[model samples]
Target chain A: MTTSLKKFRCAALSVVKHDYVARGMAAHPRFELVVVADDPGVPDWIHQRNQKFADEFKIPYVRDVERALKEFHVDVAIVSPEAERHVDLSVRSAKLGLHVVQDKPLTPSRAEADRLLSEIEKSGVRFMMWNRNGLPAVQHAQAEVAAGRIGRPRSVHIDFYFAKDAGPPRGARKTDEQQCGWLEHQIAAHVDGSDGGLGSKPMGELMIEGIYPLAYLRMLTGAEVRRVYAQTASAFHQLYVDHQVDDLAAVSLELDGGLTATIAVGRIGAASHPSGGEIKLHLLGDAGALVIAEGKPDVGVYYRGQPERESRQRRIAAENDFILADNFAQAIDSGGPTMLDARASHAIFCTVEAALESSRTGKAVTVRTF
Target chain B: MTSFFVHTADEAPWRDAARRLHQSRLVAAAGEAHAEVFDGALLTKPPAIRAALEAGRHVLVAAEPCLPRVELDSLQRAAKQRSLLFALFNPDRFLASRQLLRKQIDGPLGSLELLRSHRWENHIAPAPLGLSGSLVGEIEQAAWFYGRPVRSVFAMQPAGLNAVQVQLCFGPGMATIDYCDALQGTTLTGYRSLSLIGSRGSAQVDDHTNTQLAYVGGDGPTGLTVGEGVRHLAAMLDDFASAIAEQRDFSSTVTDALHTLDVVAALQKSLKTHEPVTLEPAEAVR
Candidate 1:
């Protein structure tokens, strides 16, 4: 086919010094890294190290995230800022006619999330969510289902675990309006504040406390969260990930086919393994079932066998092949989809939205539960 | 709830069986041949089976039951609704069976009333679901006269060395691959997945999937397997074919082509539910 759009520059909003989402984009095989942030918050040693890495890699380093986009004339801006600033950045990117690969927890609110999604669509830019980690067997199961290997799918089950980084630098804490605008700044406060002598924070923040998990659920289901019930570790007091976030939750999802998916997730004291992220999904069909015990091939699944449950002893396959940088490369080469497509990413954000709603009320919430 | 419909090609042994069956007048019929349809299932007509399916609907058919699990499951869901399993049988015999009863021909429409009065409605439904089953052992070699074992592939578990015979079955794929092609006739299938305990059952002889059985140490070297081996293949083939023609005869009580799938689903359910399931009474024809 003809070249749809060839060779476009891209800007990242998160400060360059932190090897976070920007790092993901840089690693993609397709896209060429164009520009990144320059910040004083970056330690002298870290900045020197990273700047050299960026320079050696032939990527530009700019002081302000927005300035980098305006000067380079990139076709897209990866909205990697803290949850609070996503809306403004997304709107700005859409206005610039720049396609956006937005980070999840799209926005703290549904309306804003919808508006961003609508604008991106109207701007004629592709949108997608950014979920990393080979994630074990999820993709393979999806492919198998599409291939009709398994009959009509009826149920889906997911299990997940995550740890927090309490001592993050710069905009790490969910406080600055720029860093975590729509989300409340209650990580350490509410967690520590809710200790025996302390009381829970009266102010509710979606980003730090509720948004991520809710958005994630919505994204993975790839459907409107019709209804959901979630119970978080209500009285979480221990500090594990530098921040005191409710580390675990049990959530149930009922989809269109009268099919139900139950996800068990939460944080625990020191991990027994080295998985920073994980998702275990079991897909049930008429004849048999395909269980994705590991999210990616790089991940491993082992358990102290349950009584009646069979010993899960299979090896997970590899899917760590998706590099974030390729989003730009794909956007440039095939004129097809990039990992950073806009609406799909919005969907993932919407999941976090519903999850947050369910957690706060101690009741099941619909995707549009607003 | 499993059923098997045996078909014959003007063969004497089967003809004798039919003639003897008619002569005995016990569950017998009088005509050029006797045809019978049966419900043959254990579960309450599951919703999946009810939407469509009929018995004695086809003739001259074949069945291939070795579908990948997904297709198999889908078919089960669909057939389970009607509380029907499937096997093929001859259309002519079935249609003939519905005609005037030779012995009780006192009045014209007497047979209809008698059959209807007996709830033979299942006999008139469209043909049931059908599939092909591959057969490995040479059917001809195992005939009464030839009686060869080494030639019978899937043949194992020697019943008796006195008269000495063997026949083993692999997967249903080899049983009906070539004949299972999509043909003009409707097809019904019977798959008996029985676990006989006391007399002649072996664990290796799982009925639902294809299997082998040996009649070891019989009174006189077990004339059983050799009694009518060649026709057995034809009879099995005819059952699948007849269902495709919608002409299965509803004259016998034992398993037939129409009830094969029915029986299998039931037995499977038994295995699943840990309870014995039974088929419902056949409905009266409309």
Candidate 2:
């Protein structure tokens, strides 16, 4: 296959980096990792790790975004910063006339997302979110839906449940000043200003972690979320002390076209068996139903009086971040619309924000559509 | 030695199995000379069951006993007081799939985290069985593996009584059983799938068309083949006869059946309340 290689640069703005994005872009046939711009807030250890990654990929690491933009002359910027910094990084990259490929939650809040979109629109630069669900299986499901395999979809069910983090970071000792610095930065990044710097509460986790399944449902059904009713609770995880965030949440959504969907997400204790996790998505249409049961154990090993054993395999479709990057390159080259553009990300953010509000108020909230 | 009698409704699914068991002398049918044997459908005919129990006849129910809680409880108490050998026939307990699952659970399989069983049948006919009726056997199978009483039950019948999904929470683990009766345009009898997930290993028994057992974890992927015919029914009848003649408890006794019934009852109640229903402790039943 002929390769249409494009120069790709990334702004490593978040302390918590996604290795998959970097690896995926590097592995893509049409993309070349040109430069990595490091933000000031990134810790020293993270910088070292980023440097190692850049060196291994034969790319230069620049501490300043302006320097990288001017020196690398890149075509697109893969902005994988923290949720709050997404807009700032995207707007800066857009100002340099660079198309954008950004991570999830477009921005921490809808207002920031609007500003970021306005910048990209003014710059006339192509933009896409790293929607991992835009992979083969989900796209195939979308195709099946379009082909009338299941007729008109009436309802959708999506669930994502995983084991909670074992515990807080071990052997972590920092001065009061250092701890305060980290806490302040995290609190500012939180859209709701509820971040205690420990971890995201259930709502935040749902917005970030649950967005994949939600995005998949949206892509498959092609329905806008109209209203949302959500219920959330800190069902388990006694290890968390006074953590107001919920450990379990269930959201019912009414999509624009009279399609209803339910999204359930939770951080429960690990399965006593070898099963890695449970992710189920079922779409029921007037004609028939499509059921996708992912992360189910295909093989099980049992030893008497011991935990069940099984191998956990990553969803092959989810590993297509590289494909998303490749799509970004193609969109830039051909001047066409990408699969998950800024408008789609905006709608996803609105639905997720609505669900968060509904959970907090115990009332169904209407999703704001622009 | 006590000889038991088998009585079933003419159209009962187990009638042929009962006849086979009687022919093998594992059980005796009630005839002129078998006056010591019982009369009555242990599940349907309560009046006849009372009469037979009063006559000191050993009785075996060739069907799932679904009686009102009070009546079933009273009968169980009366049977215990009179030392009557009463058995509820659930041949699933004797299926090769079930036996293989039990052996795996008891030996190689570690502590179970979850177990899921699905059974689909066509409900177009005028059969008295619905989703809950079809699930009695699966519930017993799960309980046997759990080795504990179900703590609670949450159930939903999304398609009315035609389809049901029940979630049973045991002490530390849980199980879910989904039963559907809406299968159409299928000549096959039904579909049955079982999986046992534990910490150390897991196994799945697919008893559709062929009895296929596959396991992983402890000793790796071990496959076992077993028959899917009358052998299970024969084994169940053997247990019943042994329980009667040896005066010993059987694998699936009236109490065990009652436990499953209680869970089903709780599940049914949960369906109405839209909330999980906690079951009475197993110890309280006796």
The runs of at least 3 residues in candidate 1 whose Cα sits more than 4 Å from the true structure, single-residue gaps closed, are A1-5, A16-18, A38-58, A133-136, A163-222, A234-245, A272-278, A295-341, B1-286
Every candidate's DockQ is 0.01, 0.07
Reference contacts reproduced by model 1: 0.00
**Which candidate leads in TM-score?**
2
Each prediction's fraction of true contacts recovered:
0.00, 0.03
* List of chain A TM-scores, every candidate: 0.68, 0.81
Tens-digit lDDT track for model 1 on A1-370?
A: 3244354566765432123455566555444468765444634543554466567667876666566777887776666544455667777777877766656446655678778867876777656555543333554665667666546554444545432222222223454333331123332322332211111222222233333333333434344546555444421222322333444454555555454555545432112123443344444444334435453444335566543222233344533334444444566455576543555555545545565566566444666532
TM-score of predicted structure 2, chain A: 0.81
Instruction: Write candidate 1's Cα lDDT for B1-286 as tens digits.
Output: 1122323233354444333231211122312222232222211132322222333211122222222334345534444444344332222222222221222222321211000000001012222232112211112111101111111121111111101011111111011000111211112321111110111101111111232344677632221111112333333434443443454442221123223344334434532442324444332111
Candidate 2 CAPRI category = incorrect
